[model samples]
Target: MVLVEDALLLAASAFIVTSFVGLFRVVRGPTMPDRVIAINVVGSNVVIVIALLAAAVGEPGALDIALVYALLNFLLSVAISKFTVERGGVL
Candidate 1:
């Protein structure tokens, strides 16, 4: 039987892989908005991965780190969107 910790790790791995794939969009996006959205997606995925790893390890402190990361990701996305808008990229 698959243990809970093992399952969480597997899910985290899958998210990490998907996040890497998202990086390709950031690298080759045709527009600044596209790149910004891709970066946000990857950042969100990282937060999820961190949370999952924290759960797997039974570390509550890591959850706090994940929360901080999520807040930072939100701020980054907003900042990037504002910059893109100022630069004439559509929201």
Candidate 2:
């Protein structure tokens, strides 16, 4: 179990680092879609980290929250994409 936890932590750390890299794209994006992609990456990382924490701490509520966050992320992404498409060619 300890080994499993260690692996999970390592995986979480890697994802977090990737997320930070994605964060740069959010600020330096050349296009609106690029920024949106970066934001989505961050949201995915959040979901992963939350799930890791829930497992590490044995908190079921955290898992529920993670699930909710994942759903919200997907819904928000779709809404943003639709709005961007409807808008007069990307703000």
Candidate 3:
């Protein structure tokens, strides 16, 4: 049990680090679509991290929060994509 918890924490930490790296693309992407995609990727990484932490801590309530966050992330991506398209940005 201790080993499993440690592994989960390590994996969550890795995802958090990679998400920070992905933020660079959000800042420096040459196109709106590229930035939106990077944002989506970061959001996904966050969702995974939340889920992993929830599992590690044995909190089912946190899983519900993670699921809600994942849904919000999807909606945000869709909304941004629509906005960009309306503004003449290519998909």
Query: Number of backbone collisions per candidate, in order?
Result: 0, 0, 0
C-alpha root-mean-square deviation, candidate 3 = 0.9
lDDT of 1 by residue, 1-91 (tens): 3599999999999999999999999999988888988999999999999999999988989999999999999999999898878888784
RMSD of each: 1.5, 1.8, 0.9
Greater TM-score among 2 and 3 belongs to: 3
lDDT of 1 at 68: 96
- The best-first sequence of candidates by TM-score reads 3, 1, 2
Cα lDDT tens digits, model 2, 1-91, are: 9888888888889889999999999999899899888889999999999899788766878998999999998998888888888995476
Instruction: Please estimate how well model 3 matches the true structure, expressed as its whole-model Cα lDDT.
Output: 0.95
Candidate 3, 31-65: lDDT as tens digits: 99889999999999999999999999999899998
Ranking by lDDT: 3, 1, 2
lDDT of each: 0.92, 0.88, 0.95
TM-score of 3: 0.97
lDDT for 17 in candidate 3 is: 95
